[model samples]
Target chain A: MAMYVVGHKIPDSDSICGALAIAYLKNQIGEEAIPTRLGDVSPETQFILDKFGFTAPELKMSYAGEEVYIVDHTEKTQAPDDIDEATVVGVVDHHKLGDLTTSTPLECWIRPVGCSNTIVKMMYDFYNVDIPPAYAGIMMCAILSDTVIFKSPTCTTADIKCVEALAEIAGIEDYKALGMEMFKVKSAVQGTPTRDLVMRDFKDFDMHGNLVGIGQLEVIDLSVFDEIKADLAADIIKLKEEGKRHSVMLLLTDIMKEGSLMLIASDNETIIADAYGVTVENNEVWLDGVLSRKKQVVPPLQDGFANA
Target chain B: MAMYVVGHKIPDSDSICGALAIAYLKNQIGEEAIPTRLGDVSPETQFILDKFGFTAPELKMSYAGEEVYIVDHTEKTQAPDDIDEATVVGVVDHHKLGDLTTSTPLECWIRPVGCSNTIVKMMYDFYNVDIPPAYAGIMMCAILSDTVIFKSPTCTTADIKCVEALAEIAGIEDYKALGMEMFKVKSAVQGTPTRDLVMRDFKDFDMHGNLVGIGQLEVIDLSVFDEIKADLAADIIKLKEEGKRHSVMLLLTDIMKEGSLMLIASDNETIIADAYGVTVENNEVWLDGVLSRKKQVVPPLQDGFANA
Candidate 1:
């Protein structure tokens, strides 16, 4: 039976590209794997795919009674609803360990890096498997998207080295220019629905039994959301009630400014207030130097919830 | 600060040698690491270390406020009681994923292999670090012990290949003779107390909130335990009550016969009877072709407990 390699819901560039690259690598190593996605591709990812001459992964939701290789994420909230029924054969992730258990041994390659593709690149080198040019191009774009063009705090030396190597294979001379072009597509939110923009890069976490939702939107300029902050806030409030979550937050991150405008809708406001030692005024706060949610946002919120 | 590399409480050959080899590899990569043991060294492991001219690892129980790398086991039950207070830097395991979660990303290398030392051997190759001859000799012995001289079902091509490569590095022409010599030392339970014999290779598990204890003793001849079966049964009963465990079972495995005589004392005997579809008489049953506790025993018992 072929194992379905899939990534988290609300898929981003890393989630999509990592699945495709990992599935390809597993197939090269004599394992039958099919890359699948849980959600629609974003504009940024679509641009990268078109530029690299690769097609989008097949969309799949249910995986009960099938074997899976999870990439990019390990949390149950981000997985398919019936993930407990599926057998996870392996996991290649770059996130904190989440609540997943297995009855058998598995191939687990988890590292603390900026992007999952960095670890996937290491796996390709470890197995002595050559990456195709298109795959390398797509993977390089994933690292660029994840690390915010090497400006995010999560960016590491491994990520930079991987991107440089991948760019050489991709025959791209100005990868940073390509990254800016992709970000230009991602920054366009004028006609997008408030809910769609919020759900694009959203993730839910179980913090001390409390369901907390967090979303991020990266753009070249933060001023674009000034006209729609109220709409985004209203949709975030609706999402909190719809999901029965304790809190929902969205980060409007400006790449040029290297900061975020955090919008909050929560049952307990102090959960966010005490986490970063900042005041939440008018349902929002400007967090200076907050670009990486996995590094700067989730950890403090998790600690705050633990205390609560 | 130097990270401490340690293993499970009941230190087996794989556990001890894996800690040593991983710590050595980490130090070679410019990280300070010290090998530590959770309990006293076993006779077989001590024999191998002495033959390889290596000292036993330091004995330490508490790891509060320390950074440590866990090897051989990932279970909270098998770890130190104060493990929650410590920071787990990484884990290199070869068992089913137990209930261990981290708040930060970690370097995890968990594979479905025969021995933790087999995974450690791969790690050495991954980092391009050369293993010392003494370490290679001990690691080869660990693979032999865990795989029952390549007779256990858990043994795979990877495990055999690792042992062969390690033997050449250790300058050992006939490693099978060394394995036999080690087994002779392991089979001597004549003068040991029944309680000591039972606790030598024992581990406790949390099965759906029910505490279960399982121990294994491998020998060339099963008849050596014939004279002490009743005494062993009494000790198991005492252990169950003392630890407030739901059950305590011991496996007297005959490596030559490729079977085990399971002596169980449980609050509900059907937990064992239904797991393997056997009839228990006088707290004793014979299991044919049951060699690996992890592969053949734990999964079935886990299922039975889940149903219960």
Candidate 2:
């Protein structure tokens, strides 16, 4: 059986690059695995793929009865549509374990580390497989992207070590320049559709019983939010009205400033205000020093929903 | 920051003994971990504990903020009430992964072996920690209980190896005799309240938005079901009326005969009849050669519910 290695839907740079790194490792260990994706590559991920001279993996919407290995995410909602029914053989992830149930026990390695590619680097060490320069380059890019160049709260010492070791393996003199190049691509969203822009790095959360959708878009300029704030608000309203979610939020993150301009569309404004202890003025608020949505946004929203 | 090692609620032989084994291994590795239980130990589990001169672990209903290491199971529903809020450190389980989400990544080892203790035996091997005779005895008993003396469909070659090795380690010349002793205690439900009898080994399932509960009680004699059939039916009805479940079923399994008298209480009897191609006679049917609820009962019931 061919094992399809895939990351989460709404593929981020870490997820896309992590899938490739894992597929490469699995093949080195004599497994017939193909790197795959559940969604289109985001601009940030596309930049990494182009930089590494790698093609985007074939997009698969469903994984019904397919033998697959998952990386970067383990949430059922974030996985392929038929992920629950798929024969999942292995998973390598760094995020919180989500509601993914497998039929039989599988090889799952979920480290509390920040980046999935960081864990993949450990796998390379475990197998004594030499990392190719291109693979190392993309893997290093994934770490920098997910950890926000070692600035995110999720970044750990292991992530830092992986960055240093991988940069050496990839023969990169200045890792900071590569990180800046990646972020420059992340911040280039001038002409992108508002829907694609919001959905580029989106994830759904089950807040108590409510389905909450949170999307993030990073930019160098905070004025980008001011330019597209009205359109983003309208799209959030449309998504909320679609009856799929109780709340839909977009985090327009200023990567340089290390803060986010939160655009929210929900029935309960007080709950949103109480979640972050920030007042909502016309459906927007500035969340200072909020770089990670998995850490900051999801938890408080879960608490708010629990209290509500 | 002590780690509390716990098993699922409605503690079974494997869950209880597995927690103790993992706690022992953790201590051997220089971790401050205490063995804890989510519910009262069953008669079979108690028999194993008594035979090994081990105390029942402290019962905990909730784990709000404690650092915990889970064994035997990983389902949120099976865990302590506040498991979602707990800081989970490590997990060693053999069952299908469930909806247990942690804020950070942790060490997780889930194998397809029949018993969780079988994986724990592997852990003992990996850590080069010596397994005490008493711990080995209890762990062997757990394997026998969960695997039904290697008759369970869930059992693998790893489980067989563990059984042989552990039986030798525990100095048991006749593993069958030990297995019989455990099953004897399992079959001793003569004086148990019907509600307690049914709930003793019960587990809940969310079958496509339907809350389904399936319980199993193994007996040496099939005649026990005749004596408790009406009472069991009444208790099932009471549980169904409680509105927590859409379906409630009890598998009164005869270990010697290798068959189960399934006593089901649900709004849809035709679905049950269709699931197994057996007619429901007075709300019960004999499922010959069906020893596993996880393998046989739950899947068909889930499919039947989906079709219904």
Best by TM-score: 1
**Candidate 1 stretches greater than 4 Å from native:** none
Looking at model 1 chain B, report the run of 10 residues with the lowest lDDT sum: B97-106
Question: Model 1, DockQ value?
Answer: 0.78
What CAPRI grade goes to candidate 1?
Answer: medium
What is chain B's TM-score across the candidates, in the order shown? 0.99, 0.96
Candidate 1 pairs with clashing backbones: none
lDDT of 2 by residue, B199-255 (tens): 999998777687878899988887866677789889998898796787888998887
Q: Report backbone clashes per prediction.
A: 0, 1
CA lDDT of every candidate = 0.92, 0.85
Q: Say which candidate scores most in lDDT.
A: 1
How well does candidate 2 score on lDDT at residue A1?
A: 78
Give a tens-digit lDDT track for model 1, residues A124-238: 9989999999999999999999999999988999999999999999999999999999999999999898899999899999988999999999999988898998999999999
